[model samples]
Target: MSSSTQVSGTGVVAPPDSTGISIIVVGGGFGGLSCAIECKRKGHSVVVLERVPGLHIQGDVISFGPNAGRIIQRWGLHDKIWELCRHVDKLVLHNYLGEIVREQPLPLPLWGAWGYDGHRAEMHQVIYEYAVSLGIDVRFGYTVQEYYEDDAGSKAGVRVEAKGEVVSMEADLVVAADGVKSKARKYILGYDDKPRSSGYAVYRAWFNGQEQGVDTDPLTDYLTKGEDAFFGWIGRDVHFLASSAKGGKEISWVITRKNDFEVTDNWSFPGKMEDVLAVVDGWEPRCAATLAKAPSCIDWKLIIHDPLPTWISKSARVVLIGDAAHPFLPTSMQGGSQAIEDGVVLAVALQLAGKDNLPLAVQAWEKIRYLRVRESQLIGEDVRNRWHRCQPGDRGPMLDVPRPEWLFAFDAEVNAYEVFESVARDIRENGYNRPVLPPELAP
Candidate 1:
């Protein structure tokens, strides 16, 4: 057993003996890349495989709560991330007619840390650069086709197709972070369980403030006042969320409404400006004016599957993380935050378990995460339902304002360390036991 601390991108040294297990993380998105970084910090040799040929910068803006911000700070990307993101100061809710429903202040020391609103592309670039700087092997343009485990079930790996060539790579553990439509998911469940439609679809658009004629006005002035803000308009079966990003240089909004059509699970679709306006036709002039200036938009169908029975494979050498393990509604505002948590906890568990107990580490990761993820998914569902069902007179608990402290103040790395011994002991003595929420985070 060697003991040496590896230097990370932040110039901070990780714990002693941080290297041993070889891990292959599939998908290279938020979850995969973050996991690779954490694993590398733990002294594990990690390889990240992304199917795309280049950087994936398709989506618009995303929010990261304090839960993720703390991890970013730990990883030494706090300053860089703050530079790329806008700190949200407040959230205002309005009815269809643009009447104020409520206002919530996101003061400093919010949930133990400030929140961020930024472009997804910028966030991805920051993480990608950090991963490369740390020497984590990242291979792009490789699509995974199959997953396999050794006959003895001690090792798991994947077979991928890169360009015209098929390649097989083996690792001590395989982590599938391949998004909601994961190919590795079927292998874990022994069958395909496609994501089900949430009966809702979102039309999203992002554009430069100047090009989009996004001048400050009484209706939209709240967004351009230096501090970041989220302005929402709620209507029967429809809602719109608008905010600024890239330091107010860009404006982005999403219109979510009940959909009856059976749409594909793709993240985006070219949408006409007329159609985008139609969704919010009777709501407010500011909403129309803001969206009409956008040159283009993408229509995304929201879909979700049931809670997976388990994230670990039968061999226990392979496991799922992030969306591959649990998918959440955009309403949750936790999609990226939860994925970040997954990576940290998984790495901590693997580090504590050491190489010989890889199976136990994987099981422990799933046991610790499943219930918490389910709780978030359910909260997302509840919030989505309330937002869509809200009418002129009724609006439920406004968007988890001041977000539950339990959700934001959690430190995955610390929690994993605190629970690893007990979790491993339970797994050793009684197989896998369903884990309960740490009393601090429990509702």
Candidate 2:
């Protein structure tokens, strides 16, 4: 990402005891940025190669649970980041006809909890701008065509397409934060790790309220007020979630329904308005009206894959971090959070392992994270199952979104420090262990 503006940054200074390790992070999304930022914080020389030429400030709402929130705070941006987020006081749940089921308050105060629910592009800027302030070497428009590592040479790297020619860049560690269609996956796994259809797809839209004429209708004008609101509608085989943020200036909604399209490299396409309306027929009037206010929408297919055997390659010099390693369902609401956790933990693992024992560090990091990530991924599936199977009149616990302390209460950096030594020792002696096996998260 290229920028001419000066940034004061979070005043996060790199440590003096540099790891003396060279790292290359592929991708410029949230996950990739997090890894590069954390690695730099730990005094490692890092370069981020993003295929995009400039920061594309696209995307609607994004969330950062407390688990990821704590890491942002450490970078001294807790307030600056969360301030731009919508102030969602509660999440109201209802049946298809707007029958109120439950009105759940924000699990914790927005600022106190440190978790943020805000615009995706804005949240990204919060992290990216900080990375720039720290004077990080982020090379935009650099696309990785392939990933490689040499155990013999004790290095890892990626070949990028530059000036219509391939350029090779090597580093001690190469992190694939490349998203779902990650080129690194096949290279790391020695096979095409294809994604399966989740049998569900989300039709989503985001637009400004007053600008879209939403406030003109009494049926939907409530959304134009200067207060953020969240509402969910559950049904037999579908669920709809909508929220208004930025003091009701803008609105966004997502409706999940069964999908039968063939899987391809393309995961999103323009959604048909009729199809979107059909999903909510005979449902809440306000819900339909709000959806009607949407100027445009996209059909986003939720893709899944059976958990991989490993995120690290044979050489251990290359590793997958975010969506490249694990993709979470929307219901899980922890995809981005988990990706951030991976970056933080991996950086900590590298520090503890020292520069020479790089293999041990990456292995220990995977072992430490694998099971917890699997368990977290399943949470989204379970929530979707429960909501999709809901009988219209269900009540009480059945209409709950579980934000268990186990998931949100985690402090990744501290946890990494606590577990690294023993996990590294265990991996060195006995190899990696898999204690939990969540069923394949595919329909």
Candidate 3:
């Protein structure tokens, strides 16, 4: 079949006769940019709209497990990521007293072995640059306010508020890659259920690796000092995670707590070095001393959303992806990775559908993506809650509930499709069914 074909009755313009689909991805973060690039690779036109001025969404450090690392490698971003990422070689869990509690070596044998590295900024830059190089029309500072759809509920477009004007643009498909607190999601939800704040606050900071000198023997004793691994000092209600980043040029510090104050989901706020210091004042001298030299900090509040009824909206000609679809806590570190996976699968599904059925392809997309993404969000929250319980003397005996292998072992491109196909088959079998879990489960 050619890339695109006009139906006998409908007049909607499709992808090029030689291309499979045309898509607009809202949000230029890792996931959005990746989807745009993958779609272009599959012979489709893509446009990325971002509210931020630049692609750099600031954060201290992020880890990509072996599964996610593979996608990063496949995207031709391995080299660039490695240049900026600190290769953590172990997984060290510690008690609030700065004592090593558990240690596991990083399983991957090669640095970029399976296509994973750990730099937030580096990964963002690579995806952003690659998307542009591939001809994705990334329009920055474009705030997408709403989505509008045709009467058929098959075609859709996004309404944007940019530069003192409202602009609406149409597309064969509309992807809401917007972050949590997404405006597009409201249209997809068709109801009002806002994201809830978890009352958790985190202070993030970065320091020069050489100046901080965190590799000293005493620090390594309890810190789980290695490549790719991180050390955490877990307390009753607060904890700190310290990891290496920027290829060892910098050390990333994070302090999280269930503070009573309502925290906003802002990641760029200037963190007070002294405020963070107050938390660990009595910790081991070595850990305290090292953190004292921290150069800068960023503040972020933890926000969470309940599981949505479904991420696809027939009336809005829009669907949610990435955080816009399912926002997870930072503890899972799978947020960015999952979005990257979504991009890849979205591109593949669109290509396979043939442009004659663009709307059908998007429906297939929601069927393929919703469950896996939903499961991921739940898993992240579970981990955060469990890890949050490991502070001080409250450290429970080795957790009886083992980690879900499916969560980390997942290969989005390979495994996510299986889930998607099932949903599509069910949809076909059930006749355009929309999932309705009990009211208690609806977001």
TM-score winner among the candidates? 2
| lDDT accuracy of residue 11 in candidate 1 | 21
lDDT of 1 by residue, 24-128 (tens): 999898899999989988778889999999996778877778888888877778788787776666677888898887676676556566566678899889999
Which of the two, 1 or 2, has more TM-score? 2
Worst 10-residue lDDT window for candidate 2 reads 1-10
Instruction: Choose the strongest candidate by lDDT.
Output: 2
- Runs in model 3 with CA error above 4 Å? 1-17, 109-117, 161-165, 211-229, 263-268, 391-404, 416-422, 436-443
lDDT of each: 0.80, 0.84, 0.67
- Model 2 alpha-carbon drift over 4 Å, by segment: 1-17, 110-112, 151-153, 432-443
- Per-model clash counts, in order, read 3, 1, 11
Clashes counted in candidate 1 amount to 3
lDDT for model 2 comes to: 0.84
- Worst window of 10 by summed lDDT in candidate 1: 2-11
TM-score of each: 0.92, 0.93, 0.83
**1-443: candidate 3 lDDT, tens digit per residue:** 44354421111223432473557889887778878877776667888989987666576566565556666666667777767766665656667665777665554533334424455776677767877776669998899888878887666888887888998888878888887778887787778667677778788776666665555546532332343345666666676777765444567777887765553445347777787777777775655655665766676777777777677776525778888877877776678878877877777666656667665566777666666666666655566677777644444335222234665666666654455557556656776655554443344
lDDT of 1 at 300: 83
Ranking of all candidate structures by their lDDT, best first: 2, 1, 3
